[model samples]
Target chain A: MTWVTFLGNATDPKIGGIAFFGIFLSLVVFLIGQWLFKISNGFFLFQPLFVGMVLGIFILWLLSKWFGVALPTFYTAAYKPGGDILFWFLNPATIAFAVPLYRRNDVFKKFWLEIILSLVVGMVISLFAIYYISKGLGLNNDVISSMLPQAATTAIAMPISGAIGGTPAVTAMACILNAVLIYALADILIKVFRLNSDPVGAGLGLGTAGHTVGSAKAVQLGSVQGAMASIAVVVISIVVDVVVPPFAHMMGLF
Target chain B: MASNATQAKNQAPEHEPAPILQQMAIFASVLFVSSLISPLFPKSFPVPTPVIGLVLMYLLLATHIIKLYQIEKMADFLISLIAFLFVPSGVQMAASLNVFTEHGPMDGVMMIVTIILATIILLVVIAYTTACFMWVSRKLFHKSTDVE
Candidate 1:
């Protein structure tokens, strides 16, 4: 079929036209984001994924306007087909985390005690900190519940948030916000905190606070840092799995 | 001889990536098994399905059931796109923007500040504590465990 014919059929929910258009737009938007990132020399605001999502949403809104449909309906009919398919891969992508974790098992083996202990301690401290901080700021229980699991990566955090009566969408936004802030401010934080003395600690901090994006930055730092960051992601997720539920129950969040 | 095998394993990914078809088959099989296994976990603590898959993959690699070269390229490719895969969820934020603005702007600002402050605290605590512990342990037992 001609490209015009295919695109013209986008309004019909049953046809693959809108699905293909959604995928095409996502990729093109991603490429545009990458180009901006490259030109801006790695500015955090130009983060390709963030830029792509924002731009993609804006375009989807425009498409809805052009088609004279509500945003939600248009997104459900047109964009969600391809978007859901891309989201499905997040599961396998998460599993792919094992590659680096396996390669870096040596670090875990040697420093298991230190790594686990420090993370557990930090986890407890952060849990209390998040709880009190939110309460102090007069935020409601739902927001507090969402923030509680923010230390974990997005995949793991969302389920825990939902179980504990929190909004998974907000949980995701908090996760990405934490990641972007860490990615942008890591260098300065390291300098201020004197984290240069321990790459492993720095890496773990990045992964625990920032998730995969932080790990991406960790990879840029060095192999050891990359490995540690990967391990930290796994450990922190496991910790959140074990810890957040009980903590939430005790706090009456659930 | 043992060291030589280790060296070869380490160098494998640098040689060439696995073919696309092979990578797809591996990922498909892994996901299938993980889907079957994830439902077995208890309800109170719902460990994510992908995490179960992660553990499964780690075990396979650790026991040499799957070598690094077999899935290295595919893993890297997927991991790199992690940020991209998250975009849809991020875009969903557009729908929830009212959550922030429902209250006055000051309430929203406070919530943002709370999240940022809590994060900064988490970062500092984890980094410093981990570093201090590692340093202490190394000083006590200098058995060449230093990552540097």
Candidate 2:
């Protein structure tokens, strides 16, 4: 009814009652989001984070069309200042994945030969599939760039999208899409291809592209895959770091 | 590698340095602090700071500046929470969809297409690199075995 409700208000409210209200509202939203995330994810489909983004987008799209309203934000991350504060919160959580990263190091060290070869094989397969699909569907550079880092963890992918001028907002969407698509389809693909369910096999597939969400899926598969996925998160991050900037600069898009 | 991983990281490796929980706490704190601090840095590039934080974490681990035990708890928690973290972002999709409806569809299709194309190109590189590494490794392995 009000402008606040219609256009979405992000005016800086005073830090007291608004603070309590913000926290309470955030908590409530958190719970509901958690519930939706879990319901789709309860069956252990891809990561709930991925599903949440898609579902959120779909919900927002429907709401606006039906009611002529927009969702609310605390900060102007939607338009200015920076990315959504929620993204900032998610960014910190990325660090929480140090265990997998550490284990990945151990796995790579131990099975250096096997890990390398298997990773290469997995990497090739995932990339080809993505490239062909995107092209066949006729997507543009920005969307594809965002999708390119899909398999990498979010912490790394977000910037990868940002680096080459891929929209973080859209990159955020791609991150979710990649996580969901891979998380949902990985096991099937593995089974379909008759790929070994070994740690190296599973981890390479998930971590190399699925990012952290994929690693979580790998954990459900087995510890070895889980460990490798963690390290892959880091390794892939490193890979992106080296690969993105030079490529972007060379392309002269910058 | 096995010996280093299982033995070096074992909690009771004959000379326990700290409680496991303490180790985990320290590790988690490092991750959290690093993650928070990363976004604070200058963003000269289009990429966000969290990516920088990831690289920094990797370097710290690789260089032995921050050992695994210290960060295990944090790592585990973050991985576990990965799915739930996207909720707020999901909510944004709702609004973006509406904006398009108001402005009309395909308003940002070009932006979308460019992003999608970039992803394809990046993946092509990743796949190609992976294949190349495999080929080189195999070549080196064969050469080493012949010499041996």
Candidate 3:
């Protein structure tokens, strides 16, 4: 038993072959996504991350079938190595959010109580609404769990989702979905709600529901709304971090 | 108020972004130190290491122990790549493709409906609630001089 077997069966050349190929495959697919996103002029539908994931999975499936291997076996062998490494960076990325929160500390200082109070109320109400709606619709517990933390940006939301026994992948999709919905609806929502007079409230709402994408839309509305949205993204993430785990525990979701 | 914010931003001391290698080193050290500190907390209420790192980073910035210039570029870089970083986990969804089809298309449709409906309700509720609170706060805290 050589040291190589400790990692996996060393005698099998395919193991080493796939490892290098896996990293290359992930990078190439991601680069392709970036390219497509660029050419598409940053269209929401061509978002690089979303496009990369779908394309990567599709290509991996094709490779698995071509190689006469099981999908799980191929994935663990070929994609998981690079994929896992990429996923590990999510931790540091989560910490990077502190920068924006710090930069916009002024807005927070002025309306700290109002911002915190409103977000908490919104979060609590949203949680109850999501849980009961999912339950009433007879969605599975895993699906419900994923949907619970969709309000926060993906960096923060994914960890909380996993902690509370949700599927992080599903949570990721939900976060993106939430943002896209907000992007599409912001115009009509503003007009119907007559939010023209209150940019701060509008911004907070955008960031709370949409995360980054919503913030982008908020930016288009006005500078004040943009700043508010940015502030809301960080603050809501913090609120979700402190509040969701306990809430989930009490609800017996974990 | 918007002009006030721009004025505040202008008042901030201008600093060039840190050199790239130094930026990476600073980030790496923070991540390392944070991983070490996160375990000190009791297991009963688990806070993820990254969350702890966020607070630590905030304190460092607030105290000026670590200048914003040093990490701002790197931090922005990381935030931009969040989608790319999650590709691995998102791809894992491939493993569970059966989820959508296990109960047949009807169940899958129901699941989609549930997610969409819940998201819409949350969006509307949060927006109106936040706006309402802001309005009330302003009214309470800043009364008209006419009252006098």
Candidate 4:
């Protein structure tokens, strides 16, 4: 369904071929999704990747309605970049992040050692392990490292991949995929391992390894974990941005 | 001095004014510091201020100079906003129709394949490492208790 018709498809997504209303429809869906986010007990914070995907589905149905095209079938293969209207709605997001960065000043300064350590270790193990193992598996480098920062934030991960000659598109894609999968899998992993299930433990794992998606999982575990996870996301994204490229260059891996 | 003496009779909260104002102050401080110090890091860092500012926050919070409860709502607020920020990029990915014809299947194919493998392997390693740390910390905690 094309976005142009997303009042459940210009009053009916099945009626495809609304032609030029695609952007308009995406805007409507984005507004609805944003509202849903505000009202949904804050579930999207933990499951952003899934939230994005759910939005995508609605968008696909709407676009299909408007454009007379079948919705993209393969989940991984589908590609439309959503729409311009959606992008516009999201632009205000950077304004909202100032809260914690302000209050958590003490945590950020004192925990520098841990934050840096975790991000470096997390990115290194994740990136290289994927690279070498995938090479052993006969997959290309881009395929592996694209998932490297999957555990990291998108803004930093995308360009880091690009600088190191990895695939930015895939990096973006993998980050989303990991968030969804990890958010789903975190509990089982914790329970299966009989892990301590402490907030710090859950938070670090979520922030360092799980990224935003993991944080979502962390929140479900408890608020302390959520706090840790949130801080971790910011720290890891910063670390990945500042450290990965030069480190990648120094190692001559690119 | 007078307020300190009066505190024995009735406790007054010195640290927090109200949740909202404190949150605003915290936010303002971080943004200012991050913008000022962001340049100390290399060009590759993804975010502008909060990254550096976060380092500062961690230091203050851990030292008892700043308390977590003071900024709880503010922290939650940041987490809440994460979803909306990525909507544009997510939408772009969900909507781009001619990607195969435009970017070609070879690079895109290779890219998707790599991402899948990386994510699976990453999850395993992270889970393992976290368990290891938890084990180590527990063992160390026990050892310290025994010594005491």
Candidate 5:
């Protein structure tokens, strides 16, 4: 009915090239969200990624509700392929994290024991807490399994979730939500606990609970803290991957 | 003149700016190789392609097979844009709206609150425990240098 075909034609890929357009639009929306975040003086609630997600969702909703376009049509035409390509970058991006770890090799060597101990303890606490909380909440086993690996990065969490009979999408959501929570509240927790004095412990705690976004916060604290956070993300992720499956299986969780 | 010559000999070569194209190529090649190997393992395997890619890249850097300068720019660029890569996944949360609706908004709020509280408690406990360990180890080892 309308001439705004550039948005996408659900049936015709060649007419609109909506996959590429969707990515371009998502980036534009994200940049605007970033600008809003900056103007808000770095409010965590205004985090660009979260804002972008809300905006993207709203756009899809609008197309369906107001324009009379079906949801499935819009999804296949735009979101799926665009989202898949962007998601693919997550793999290489994870590998790139090693650069920071390599750059701070000295810190790793200097505080190896302390760092490893903190991560292991933190991870155990996280898994236990999730288990008890989910049980208390009366969540099903599948939901509990998905929520178990929320502390790890998405790249690592998804596989562990799958292996343990969890939903990958739910796991991804949990991981992102956890990161946002940590990013928003790291300072409050640090101040309340008097954690400012020990940067290595602080970084490890943040990364173990919060993952990459938490590491971003750690970077602001100092280089050693950032490096420690980077190491925690990788080490804790690997440890969780190895430990969660058999542990869950043994516990009859899977 | 002899001292000056010796100094010159000891100085390392000044690293030229790495070509962006080459750096990108190297980064892409490494990821490509990783993706190729990722599927060789069964789907049941918990280890993912990214972990393998990360290890491969780290080994290359540590072994001097790939200089930091060669991949530094591309790596940093990718890392800085890392948050962007998560946008689509975050947007996918839209699909879970049904879950929230089915459980009721109160339950959803309670779940989130519980998660946040648990995470904060976990963070504090871990930090304090680590500090205690460090202090105890320093005292036990009688190596003040070990604490820092």
Candidate 6:
């Protein structure tokens, strides 16, 4: 068999397409997303990450449907391995977040009390809001758990979901959706609520509600706002990590 | 802080870039340590190891064990590419298409609407609440101290 066939064929477990295809496809999709974002003038809704995800999903769906590829077989053979490696990198990347936090340690100290109070209140409200809303919508526990940590970054949210018995994919989906929604609507919300004057407050809210994407928006606002947002991302993650599981347990969510 | 900032700026031209190999090694060592200690905790522990890794890095920096100059470039590069790392998992969402289809289109729409609404509410509430707290605190502190 030729080298191309060895890499493309789904049935061949050892030398199959799973090893390389996912990385290649991811890069291609990323480029497409970047192009879309560039042409769209860096519109938040046109974020390359979200674009790439949707495109990747659609392409996979098309492959499965039009080309008669067996999804289950392909998933186990190709997607899982490739995706797993990339997912593993999220850990180190998350660790890299410390660089920013370290850089802005003074800001953290200056507003530490305000940051803590805001995050605590925001997190409580977020948890309760997601709980009741998803429950009222008749969603199951897994879905509820997945959505609970939606306000956090994916690296933080995914494990929280696992600890709480939710699927990581659903949690990831919710987190991304949360970020996109906040990114798209943050300005309007700020204007409507008259939050334009308080950059630190705005940054904390953005980070607490929107995580990394929100921080990106905060960065656009100004350096102090960006720093505050970055700090919020870490603070909120740590707060939620320490508090959510117990809260979920008390609520009998698990 | 001003002096430190200026010093950093002045040192910029003289500072040589840390070799890529050394930077990678530092990153890998931190990651390795994080992974090593993460599994020691029970499954129910809320704080995951990556977070622990982050805290460790922060502590190292605070204590001057790891200088900012050593890892700044590598860390920035990794963070810039962070979204790229997440794409694979995002792609894996394709596998869960059955979840939406199985629940039917109406339910899916409801789910989407519910999530969007919740997110907006959360953002508004969090931002406003934080602003309010800051305002209140400033008032309280100012009144007690008799300062502007």
Q: Fnat per model, in the order given? A: 0.61, 0.31, 0.52, 0.23, 0.52, 0.56
Instruction: Provide the DockQ value for model 6.
Output: 0.50
- State the lDDT of candidate 2 residue by residue for A58-150, as single tens digits: 544454445554443322222212224445556656555555555555655655565555454545454455555655666556555555555
**Per-residue alpha-carbon lDDT of candidate 1 for residues A165-205, written as tens digits (9 for 90 to 100):** 99887787788778756766777787888876788888888
TM per candidate comes to 0.86, 0.65, 0.74, 0.62, 0.84, 0.83
Residue runs of model 6 more than 4 Å from their true location after superposition: A1-18, A135-142, A152-169, A179-196, A216-221, A249-254, B1-14, B143-148
Residue A52 of model 2: what lDDT?
51
Best by lDDT: 1
Q: How would you encode candidate 6's per-residue C-alpha lDDT over A1-254 as one tens digit per residue? A: 64333334555666544466777778888898889889988776666777777887787766666545666545555566667767787776667767766666655656678778888887888788778888888887877777777766676778888888877876777776776566667777778887757777777877777776676667667656766777777788878778788888888878
Per-candidate Cα lDDT values, in order, are 0.77, 0.52, 0.70, 0.53, 0.71, 0.71
What residue runs in model 1 are displaced by over 4 Å at the alpha carbon?
A: A1-13, A65-69, A249-254, B1-17, B103-105, B141-145
What tier of docking accuracy does candidate 6 attain?
A: medium
Clashes of each: 0, 34, 0, 52, 0, 1
Instruction: Write the residue-wise lDDT of candidate 3 on B1-148 in tens digits.
Output: 4353344356446777889899888878888898899688654334556767777887787666887778878887877676567567657766766666666777677766776776676656767776777667658867221100
Candidate 3, lDDT over the whole model: 0.70
Judging by lDDT, tell me the better candidate of 1 and 6. 1
Assess the local accuracy of residue B144 in candidate 6 as a C-alpha lDDT between 0 and 100: 24
Estimate the Cα RMSD of every predicted model relative to the unseen true structure. Answer: 3.6, 6.6, 5.8, 8.4, 4.8, 4.0
lDDT of 3 by residue, A151-253 (tens): 8767667878888998877787677657545655667767887765666677788778877556656666765676567667767777888778888888889
Name the candidate, 1 or 3, with the larger DockQ value: 1
User: i-RMS, every candidate?
Assistant: 2.7, 6.2, 4.9, 7.1, 5.2, 3.5
Distance from true location, Cα of A166 in model 2, Å: 4.8
Query: DockQ (Cα-based) per candidate?
Result: 0.55, 0.27, 0.42, 0.19, 0.39, 0.50
Arrange candidates, best DockQ first.
1, 6, 3, 5, 2, 4
Residue range A1-254, candidate 4, lDDT tens digits: 43333322323346633333434434455566556657885453434445555676675656455666655532122332234433433222232322333333333343435445654666667666765655665655544444455566666677778867777776766676566556545666667655434434456666665665466556656644555566767766765665566656654556
- lDDT-wise, the better of 4 and 6 is 6
Model 5: colliding residue pairs: none
Runs in model 4 deviating more than 4 A are A1-52, A57-61, A64-123, A143-145, A196-199, A238-253, B1-29, B44-47, B59-70, B78-89, B95-117, B137-148
Candidate 5 C-alpha lDDT tens digits along B1-148: 3343233223324556489999878878888898888778765544567767777887786666877777777777877886677777666665565554456776666556666765776577667767876787689976452322
